[model samples]
Target: MAIPPGFLDELRNRVSVSEIVGKRVKLVKKGREHSGLCPFHNE
Candidate 1:
């Protein structure tokens, strides 16, 4: 049940926020971050 030390950091280094978020939402790069209209809030 417990995760190993540095597991999350290693996993995050291997993956990307855009790659994960892009799967469900349309993303646009804005400076240093990505943005998109929320499907639930639509704002």
Candidate 2:
């Protein structure tokens, strides 16, 4: 099945990257973006 156009854009506008990633990882605010250690790899 194909997704309708604008659906992802609308979802992204309603949701935030930090909000989703923060649940599983510790994030730090870095200017306009977020930074965190990778959860899947040892860094």
Which of the numbered candidates is closest to the native, going by highest lDDT?
2
Best by TM-score: 2
Model 2 Cα shift for residue 2 (angstroms): 2.6
Q: Give the alpha-carbon lDDT of every model.
A: 0.89, 0.94
What's the alpha carbon RMSD for model 1? Answer: 2.0
Which tens-of-lDDT digit does each residue in 5-42 have in candidate 2?
99999999999979999999999999999999999998
The sequence of per-residue lDDT tens digits that candidate 1 reaches over residues 1-43 is 9999999999999999788888989999999999987868866
Q: lDDT of candidate 2?
A: 0.94
Ten contiguous residues with the weakest lDDT in model 1: 34-43
Per-model TM-score versus the true fold: 0.64, 0.75
